[model samples]
Target: MVIEYSGIVVRSVLTDKREKFYDSKGIGCYMFRIDEAEVVDATMHGSAARFINHSCEPNCYSRVIHVEGHKRIVIFALRRILRGEELTYDYKFPIEEPAAKLPCNCGARRCRRFLN
Candidate 1:
């Protein structure tokens, strides 16, 4: 079945010169990496999309869309999702240091032991 995603846009906390930002406990999930030094926090905007969880094998994927010269992150379904299924997407946070490794509880068939 086809599913349309929608949410609010909010400014993200700026991380300097970093390609990725991950928060284990924060509401923020996906960061719109504008460039090497700029990122727009899509989660800070009070959107329900921020609550969407992460999975190694996700049924949805985040795509970057540009509107009015601003970059926005949007989630799109990859396959049919039955009703009551939890919406999920891959965080895809960059794995740079060992400390960046986070345990996964997604329970997908292809669980990547740790989330980057």
Candidate 2:
């Protein structure tokens, strides 16, 4: 028997290409840190996964999968998402200073005003 799943689809990557635009604007954020000098920036070649917005109270979350010395970001649903609902997840980036906070428009009831 063949089974089919229909909700949100995720993709994977295995490269490190810097985004000068984000770096220049200082608005870009790292998806995951692989090492002291390297980070996984989904915007480099992201798919639908990149488009997923951030929510303080996200319905989805990401998990890192290490395989053959490479790190991949996998997103999983935290609950049964209904059709037409926007897929969102927390960026989970650390915030050390007020100057580092970015603006957020997620529209979540618990929106923190800034994306940390």
Candidate 3:
């Protein structure tokens, strides 16, 4: 595994409130959803892994693991990674309407053009 996507575990319902709070404070928010019921709020408490960007064809991938009865998100290498290479993984964001689509900038040859 490359790293654990660590942060304060929170209920999915509270994410909106927390995001708004961070926005009001002008702090960038970092989050990783574990499922419909939980999310990891990495805005204030996170590691360098939080800064990893998204790629259409990623060298890494994330997986949810249950440890001690609690679920955790872990980033793992999808293949061999060379030293000094930037780590990336697919965000796999849900598809949205054309008006709400987020553009992809990973620059991969197979890039979908849109992140969602």
- Per-residue alpha-carbon lDDT of model 2 for 1-116, expressed as tens digits? 01111222123233222345566777553345544544555544444566777898898887766659765567788988889988888886668598777888888888888887
Local accuracy of candidate 1 as per-residue lDDT tens digits, 21-103: 34544433544454454465545543566667889998899877667996656678899888999988888877868876888
TM-scores of the candidates in the order shown: 0.68, 0.66, 0.96
Which numbered prediction scores highest in lDDT against the true structure?
3
User: Would you list the C-alpha lDDT of every candidate in the order shown?
Assistant: 0.65, 0.62, 0.95
Per-residue lDDT over 7-116 for candidate 3, one digit per residue giving the tens place of the 0 to 100 score: 99999999999999999999999999999999999889987889999999999999999999989899999999999999999999998888999999999999999889
Better of 2 and 3 by lDDT: 3
Model 2 residue 38 lDDT score: 44
Q: Positional deviation of 5 in candidate 3, in angstroms? A: 0.1
Q: Considering every candidate listed, which one attains the maximal TM-score?
A: 3
Clash-forming residue pairs, model 3: none
Return model 3's CA RMSD, one decimal. 0.8
Please give the ranking of all candidate structures by TM-score, highest first, separated by commas. 3, 1, 2
Clashes of 3: 0
Error of 2 at 22 (Å): 5.6
